[model samples]
Target: MYAWAARWRNAQRPKDQRLRDAERSGRPPDQRDQITQKLTALMSTTPTAHGYRHPNWTTPLLVAHLAREHQLEVSARTVRRALHGLGYRWKRPRFVLSRRDPNLRQAKGSSRGD
Candidate 1:
């Protein structure tokens, strides 16, 4: 249809006369790169190392940290999307109690009736 006709018309034009891709219209590209680099650098280390009281990173915490440390304002959802694009995955930390107490099982059993 229209596309075929347009392609046929384009084929007839000289190589240099052909239409080029439209320039992207939006925020400048460098801003995105700067944000991405800052995010990646932040992710490479623990929050505590950066003077954040938290032991690990959360989406909201990351947003606040970015604004505070890097002066980059972004939303938690944006942070999550950036993290996803960078191939990072979130997993919960596992906690296991050590078997240092011999009476641990007995104490738990005794408490069950209450």
Candidate 2:
């Protein structure tokens, strides 16, 4: 295949040249450490502090905030992956009425004498 041919050709190159990859230009890899540090700092505060309506941080919201404030454009999935790599876990808060409040709504709706 062409790959084998290219490998053989590359083998014939000077040792110094073969040791280094050919020069190329394109977007580089994401800065995981920077993202992690940002996330850690951001997590210490509520989203409202950053002018977000929601109090908690979501992947999409994080992505948007990073793009708008930090000028770092990345996908929600990227943020999610970074969070996972940082050992962050996501948990949804549960809202429920207390067991002693079962009839609290009815009592509040009815008059004290009735």
Candidate 3:
């Protein structure tokens, strides 16, 4: 309860530092489309030094990675927006559960269940 109260108090305080930091940057941000295009071309043909490690930096992978890695600058939501503009949709394999198998997610449990 103490920790929760402390977190709640912190959340109530306005984000002054973040606003100041943004003002300090003093420039408009780069366009994601341009960045995506550049990153896509570079990854598709060019052999980057880091390419050995980041081999699967394709268009989708690039978006996904940026969405994960540079989360502050590039979020998964923004990546989804970009992908949608490029006529792409996020799809992951869904498990085909047996009819008898119960869904654990729908089960009632405490927050500590995971």
Candidate 4:
């Protein structure tokens, strides 16, 4: 009943509907904050749930998994959200190719000279 009433009131208003906007982008300030918090928590812990130890994924890996496997519109931004929500504390290198930067790259190259 309250939801219907609120919707009716919003419908009467001519300007952008606050309630509708809230529903889409998360609104009511408080509710959005709460949901963001929840989503953040979920994102942080989702990896562990899926047996993944890392908090973030490489661009290609993320695209293939989130977009293709999970079928979610989980762009980098969304991934950030999940990380933020989860309060993730770990980070793994992405594209840290040994050839790209000698100083950073530490791939399994040939054994160092004795």
TM-score winner, 2 or 3? 2
Better model by lDDT: candidate 1 vs candidate 3: 1
Q: What is the TM-score of each candidate against the true structure?
A: 0.58, 0.61, 0.31, 0.30
For candidate 3, lDDT tens digit of each residue in 6-114? 6556755575532232336567775776656644454455334444354333445565545454543555566556656666555654668667646547557667877
Error of 2 at 46 (Å): 0.5
Off by over 4 Å in 1: 1-30, 97-114
Best by lDDT: 2
Local distance difference test, each candidate: 0.80, 0.83, 0.53, 0.53
Q: Clashing residue pairs in candidate 1, if any?
A: none
lDDT per residue, candidate 2, 13-78, as tens digits?
Answer: 775565555689879776788888899899899899999899689998999999998888888888
Candidate 4, 42-61: lDDT as tens digits:
44554547566756544444
lDDT of 1: 0.80
Which ten contiguous residues of candidate 2 have the minimum total lDDT? 101-110
**Model 4 poorest ten-residue lDDT run:** 27-36
- List the candidate 4 regions with Cα displacement exceeding 4 Å: 1-56, 90-114
Tell how far residue 72 is off in model 3, in angstroms.
9.6
Q: Provide the global lDDT of candidate 3 against the true structure.
A: 0.53
Candidate 4's displacement at residue 78, Å, is 0.9
